[model samples]
Target: MGDHFFRKLWQGTAPLVLWASHFFFCYLYAASGCRRETWAVLLGATLLALAGAGWLAWKAWRGGGEASLGVLHMARLGGAILALAAIAWSAMPLLVFGRCG
Candidate 1:
């Protein structure tokens, strides 16, 4: 927590946000019960899940894989990326249709 007191918070929250977004959107789409080539959306979700795991593994490898700290570090980073992507993807509807202010 020396140099990363707030840094880790940012890193950790990203994945949490992404995970939340994934579920939110997926459910939103599913609830509509409409069918129109869902592969793209499904693929995005799959990639995000895989990215989180990959990030953890990357940290483990970078840290020699002897300590659990590395694994955790990688996981947070992965979540951060996924979260960011989720946020971006979620915004598409807003951008296309414009949101009310």
Candidate 2:
């Protein structure tokens, strides 16, 4: 059950963890230069994070679906939602601001 511990943890919140990392890098890049390329990078990052969230949702539903993991399945779903919200929040600046002044 030792290795299974990490597996369960990842299955539980990988999407949300990835979202946190993505948010950090996106914000770091934007704050560094706010260049046009930064938005492109951010777009790519957001897409990747969203895709990860989708994968988490699909994984949780692959077998008996939510019935399989019960509370864990619900937690994964919650993580997916949070990931999407974080992605959206991180992306907003691209629409609202320009390169650093």
Let me know the TM-score candidate 2 reaches against the reference structure.
Answer: 0.80
For this target, which candidate reaches the highest lDDT against the unseen true structure? 2
Write the residue-wise lDDT of candidate 1 on 1-101 in tens digits.
Answer: 56776676655565676567566866686566545545456557646655764564355346544544664566665565555565456546534643232
TM-score of each predicted structure versus truth: 0.45, 0.80
lDDT for each candidate structure: 0.57, 0.76
Among all candidates shown, the one with the greatest TM-score: 2
In angstroms, give how far residue 60 of model 2 lies from its true place. 2.3
Q: List clashing residue pairs in candidate 1.
A: 15-79
Residue 46 in candidate 1, Cα distance off native in Å: 2.1
- Kindly give the stretch of ten consecutive residues in candidate 2 with the minimal lDDT sum: 60-69
- For model 1, the superposed segments whose C-alpha errors exceed 4 Å read 1-4, 60-101
Error of 2 at 5 (Å): 1.6
